[model samples]
Target: MTRVVVHAGFHKTGTSTVQHALAQNRDALAPHLRIHLREDFDPLTASARSWSVTRSDKHFAAIGRNALRFFRSIGREDTRPVLMSSEDLCGHMPGRNGIAAYDAAPDILRVIADNARHWFGPALDLVIYFSTRAPDPWLRSTWWQNLRSTRLTKDLDPYADDLPRAADLSAVVDAVRAAVTAQVVTAPLEDSAARPEGPLAPLLDLTDVPADVRAALGIPPPVNAQPDLGMAEVLLALNRSGLDDEALSDAKRTIRRLAVKRSNLSPHA
Candidate 1:
């Protein structure tokens, strides 16, 4: 029987770094585990995100149907443990579309658990893992992300004040535990970032990828890091400028390019 580990997430918690490492080391880890990331579950992730906004039963049902279809397509004869990671599996990050918390996560995860049990049977070993970060940093990072990607005009302080409950990620995890029968595990970004493998340490540990292979795999530099303070301030200003959408996008692109150049030339970088 194959063991399945799903790293559903609380975002701004180094998920991109872990996913990057896994993708970079795919061939090296192939013998011990099979890896799946967000791209492999387009329909499921789409439905999950849709349900996050609409909260319609039909969209919710689509989540279960898509999940089962994805699982069924996997090769049954491959006994190697499967590790799938996607922050979207839970739902949209809080602050997106006025979402205050991962309130829908338990139900979404329950659907996933039910479908997995039905397809993989009683003998299947299923584990759900959540990667979390300290509240202050998580909130700040998430705020910056939204400012960059969306037209969010609020600065970090106000954003944090408005979405206080989003920081209580443990409560979200507890809800998931209550909703699903599979073992639930959590890793703090503070602890995992200090390890030799950086953010990927917890996941590599779970998949039991050999030490030699781990050492040999190329670890990429941090992925999707928040822009520096100066850049962040500029992004906030641009967001509030009320420039036309196309002009706003053009200005942001210019600023981002400059930020990258500055970062690459910095002594710390």
Candidate 2:
């Protein structure tokens, strides 16, 4: 039976580090499981757009096919664990705003469940692993990495914001949990860094790849990296500057174009 692990995130949660380590150490980890980064298995730059809520046909077709192929590969493999890492698996807009922000929670959850079921085949178990950051810092980190809009965030300090409404997390979790066997594991980034053995144990347990494999993959057993304060300052400045909707959209588009190009040009193969 093929085992599937979906590290659905609470984003800016060190997902990049996890994915990087997994990809880099593929050979060492290959025996226990094959790690599938979205683009490698699927030619489309799957995470280049918010696919769940994206309405564009071109985007949908490219992402959908890749998603299907991802599932098919898992089904065909004899591996003990097939790891799929995408922070987007968790609900986006983990806020109070309604569909105006993104698709409804249920719709997004359904799409994830459908993809997992299709890929893992019948009677699969699911785990939703996540990490926490104090909300303010997490949002600040998000703004930099995604290059979010100035206007939309004008009055708010992401760090000052509350932990996403429990109702919001619950609703999204329930939608996906109801369809499959699910468990929620939360690790605060700081704590995990200080005591990887404590907070990160569960993640390692779930993945069950050897320590050597983890080391080879460079999955730092949780280490501290400086929060790029300059990046955060620029993000905050963008919001404070108040670019209007059209300008913000153009900024976001330009950022995405560059990001996609960079992701495509990666030297790792």
Tens digits of lDDT, candidate 2, 82-174: 676665554343332322222333344445556767766676666666666665566555445444533334333543244344223334455
Q: lDDT scores for all predictions?
A: 0.87, 0.52
Candidate 2 stretches with Cα past 4 Å from truth are 41-66, 75-77, 91-106, 118-120, 146-175, 178-184, 195-202, 215-217, 220-231, 235-269
Locate the minimum summed-lDDT window of 10 residues in model 1: 260-269
TM-score of each: 0.95, 0.63
Question: What is candidate 1's lDDT per residue for 1-269, written digit by digit as tens?
Answer: 77889899978898888888888888888998999999998899889988988999999999999999989987767888889899999889888797888888999999998988888897678999999998999998899888888889887888999888889999889999999999899999999988889888888888788899888888877778875547888888898896999999999888777777777632212
lDDT of 2 at 81: 74
Q: After superposition, how far is residue 63 of candidate 2 from its true place, in Å?
A: 7.2
- Overall local distance difference test of candidate 2: 0.52
